[model samples]
Target: MYENKISARQLRRMIFIETFGAGALSIPAFACYKEQNGFWSLIFYGVFLAGTIAFFIIFSGKISEENFENRKIGKTGLARNVNINVSKMQTRLKSINFPEVLPQPIKFVYMIRFFINAVALFYFFGKTIQTVYMPESSFLFIIFPAAILLCYSLYTTLQKRARFLEIIFPWIITTYFIAVILSFIGIEKAMQIGNAGELWQGILSDNIFRSMGNGYLMLLCSSPIEFLLFLRPAAEERGTETKNRKVEDKNNKEGKNNREGKDDKAIRDIITAVAGAILCNVLFCFLSVRTLGPTLTSQSEWPVIKMMQLIRMPGGFLERFDILPIIFWILCMMAVLSGYLYYGWSIFQTRSGGCLKNFLGITFVCLVLLTCVVEKHTLLWTFYLKYKAFVDFPLSLILPLVVWLFKRQKDFNYQEKT
Candidate 1:
């Protein structure tokens, strides 16, 4: 029964893996380049504090239809909310209502932004892979495996894919941390950890806009609302930690109020995931200055890689091993690609009523590949994202309003019926 399903912890890790993907590698340089030593404070503020608010805003819409709780994962790559309480079919139908004017426009806007996100991420990820791991390999060769993994994640069980991320992601992070420490410790003689004051001075200036933007993008990229698409409430016979709260407070108890436990758990998981992203970004930013100093960090091609190359392993039998951060980066970039592709495919399926299927999946991947091959330059793709950046702001701000309206209507009807 749980074949294609993941536990709450796994879902949280998936968000972490997704959030830390493309941005973590590059954001540090952007942060340091923009704010230097003071980048640390901005990372905390923009990515963590603001990000948590964004997650809550999106989730506060309250999407629990316990009467329609059908967690079955069937063929055709669709897991739907089967309305088993057919006697209340009218209310269930009412609950799913769309705004009179926003239905088509909403779907269109969502797809366009989602498409732009997928394309930019895919191209950059593939380009980064080539630049780092296999410089000699053809561009198509670098992207092929990533495309395959993305397709599998989309067409197959997301739970299985999420579980895989849950298991291996920790090790990848550990490896990254070890590499960073080794790089810093080995370069202690050359390191100049001072001049962080300038970063602090610049924090409030217009100069910090790029740093803030980088942090916000890191948070935005792995938004928690998408979690709703795959969510089926955690099975609670006795309820876990939340049950303790339930058993502790009898006076607070009301009919079906226990459902709120899942809501709390979801919020906790989102906080955990966003915290991880914040840490990774901070560490990467610190890695730049801690190794290369503030001034030098701004002038490098990939400053993070430069920091990594400082690691000098001492050994007799192994001789002196060299640095290899490309492995970690390649893995991260691949994760970013999968995250975008999976999110886009999920929304497409929901909107198309599963008609797109694998055909939609194949076409999307091909478009990315074709574009990369044709353009032959990653900078153009980055420029495209900047040009179309307006697509994302409205999605984040507008969709939450829609969900809020939906919830308001839902509660009014429920109160009238009760």
Candidate 2:
């Protein structure tokens, strides 16, 4: 049934939309917001999520069309009937001289990044499980198996979905939102924390700004997954056109040879990438601060959660709706795993020759182990907020800056060549 139905475009949508917003990283965003802003902040969060989804939809359409055109050109080995225009891809490629499509190295630094994220997420996930669910006796057994399964499932799922990341992503996103809202509704009113008035004020003030920053940082982990997601539909479309052109190579050969062409810019592509980074990061900060910034630090085993034990959400109708949040969490967790797994596997497939991939995988494994050990032992339990701040803020600024510097060097070299 699935085989006959899925298309390349749909697969691209799924990868970008579904996998991009996965669980491993999103929980931190939720935790941050809940700790700082309290429950009502979710309203604003929903709005922001909706807006990004819309932006993704428009961009995905443009990218898919260009990819299709490229495939046709490749298939016929000639350019025909093609109308040239300025596009996001052209702009992005302009910055790096297209980098000659070199193999990506998974070096020591890449491994370090992976390990840090893995360990952090592992610890956070364990703590959450202990607090919100039952404390498992074997943390390693629980986390490792869960992580591996998620990765494997995601790798298989994307291929099965006709490689439509965009289509899959929207459903995942919608499911995640519903889950969060349902969880908010289900918390017992008796379990609600913080004074309503104070929380509201915090939500309106600098708290929202903090949330926005965290949101941007979270996007960093997810953005790579988004880029890969766009590839599925693009690939499928190209493949289809390639097959069709193979059959028509003779009759249309002369006309295809008689076509006109224009220059495509790589500058625009780089600018678009940088612009996308900035816009996403800024919006993330506002949403995080407004909805979950103040309460996030507190709720997630931080100093704040301890202080606010007195105030709790009234379960109200949610008490009757207990099953919903559990279901939502399950779905969200799946989405997150799918994302990480998809990217990890893709890395393995495309660039396994270098030490970088091995290093990265090992680093992530160490991180997962470290997190389990830290939480179980209560290590670094006190300075958690400071540590989190360091990780989130600096990385958010560095990604775009590095991209920009590389772009500058490329431009200078281009001018020299001219």
Cα TM-score per model? 0.74, 0.49
The best candidate in terms of TM-score = 1
lDDT of 2 by residue, 1-418 (tens): 2332234345334443333333332434453543544233334443444444444443333332221122232322235335543221111111111112222432232334433444555566555555554665566655776666543443354446444343344455465455444434433342334587876666575466655654544444443333322332233332444444454444334423321110111212322333443343233333333333445533543222222232234543333332333343445444544544444444444455533435445544754666666776665653554554575335423433344355456556877996
Task: Name the regions of candidate 1 deviating beyond 4 angstroms.
Answer: 1-5, 40-104, 195-255, 315-324, 355-361, 377-379, 406-418
Q: What is the C-alpha RMSD of each candidate to the true structure, in Å?
A: 8.2, 10.2
Instruction: Score candidate 1 by TM-score against the native.
Output: 0.74
User: Candidate 2: deviation at residue 32, Å?
Assistant: 7.8
lDDT of 1 by residue, 127-177 (tens): 666676669998777666666666666675555666677777877787677
User: Judged by lDDT against the true structure, how good is candidate 2?
Assistant: 0.41
Q: Clash number for every model?
A: 0, 74
Among residues 3 or more apart in sequence or in different chains, the pairs in candidate 1 whose N, CA or C atoms overlap within 3 Å are none
CA-lDDT, candidates in order: 0.57, 0.41
Residue 4, candidate 1: alpha-carbon lDDT: 38
